[model samples]
Target: MKTALENVHDWNFEINYNTVTAVVEFSIHFVSTEQYPLLEYLLTNGTKSLLLLPDDWKLYEEHLSDNEYRYYLGGCIRAFDIDTLIEILSSNFPCIYSRLKKNSIDALLHHDQQAIHGPARLIGEPDRYRFLNCILNAKKQLKSS
Candidate 1:
């Protein structure tokens, strides 16, 4: 079976600014933590100490731009990464679901509604309901399950 890290490597976040680079590199760092195994991973693995080169450091710089730095800071983003699966096993990390809802709500209010809603409708019939439900009931289901 593919590890959670490998699984997250395939996930991408399309932010409006320079977050693409930070997100990719952050994904790489999380992928490196797969060795620690489910619950123990975040606590035992040295992910917090992962080093970035100078170029990679520049991508996360606060002084570079306004919008870029804010979104890329990873405060509580919903973007898919190794943590999405890890969050299932560990409560120490922030949940992606909460962040996703914040993103979706913010998108609905500020961004083009169609841009957010239209593609969601395009989800195939069989899985569409489940997909939307997952978004709607993320926290409740997480607790129940």
Candidate 2:
């Protein structure tokens, strides 16, 4: 099958993660073949998140209203094991973080929540709790400001 993003090249985020993170949305126009069922994204942490796209990037259109984007993000983040995530945080990756530091872990949890909850609320199901609890204890501090 052909991929929706077949010819597309790598993309860049204008904003980098500092105190807050900026998500760079990925898009692929349309596709005929089933080329891209998987999306591989690298996090600020060295961890790599791989998500399975429905059939193509365009498939997102059918379920975009359900916050599938963020959910996919969570699922992708979940793809990497805890060890990998830890390694990523310790590394120099822009999204890299520190589980040891409250702020760092909070940010990671917040990042996952933004991606997962938004979509889970929209789509409904399985991915809802994935890695989300990592920051549950700190929600008040992170969300309130």
Candidate 3:
């Protein structure tokens, strides 16, 4: 049986910049079941550590009701700032981060969105390839132990 991470064919980082509020909203989308444990592992135990900060925890609490927060914690869906998004990518996927940092976050995200594969409507294959390679390498390391 394929692992949850293995089942993931593609994923994306979505950015929504509010010109009026000047807040850069971010989220992640991928092809995995909501019940996948890897999602929780990525949010809680991954190198990026999304919920580690008090402010982020408070923001989740304030913005989401109990059920919504549960889903967020489960990694079904999430909403956060650009900085958090940057931190997550930089820590977890440095190769992709290196490519993305050449331009402003808004411009980079827009460019990446335009680069998505038309048939799959997924993030650019180059980025996804690097991401999956990193993930598979990590999984290999864990298994070899």
Ranking by TM-score: 3, 2, 1
Worst 10 residues of 3 by lDDT: 68-77
| Candidate 3 lDDT, 1-145, residue by residue in tens | 1122323334444334333433333344344332221122222114444432112332221123322221222121233433444454445332221122233456445554532211212234455455445444443553464
Model 3 stretches with alpha carbons more than 4 Å out: 1-4, 37-49, 52-145
Winning candidate number (lDDT)? 3
Residue-by-residue lDDT tens digits, candidate 1, 63-123: 2233222112222223343243233323222112111122345445654433332111111
Candidate with better lDDT, 1 vs 2: 2
lDDT of each: 0.26, 0.28, 0.33
For every candidate structure, what is the RMSD over all alpha carbons to the true structure, in angstroms?
Answer: 17.6, 16.9, 18.3
Measured on C-alpha atoms, candidate 1 has an lDDT of 0.26
Count clashing residue pairs in model 2: 13
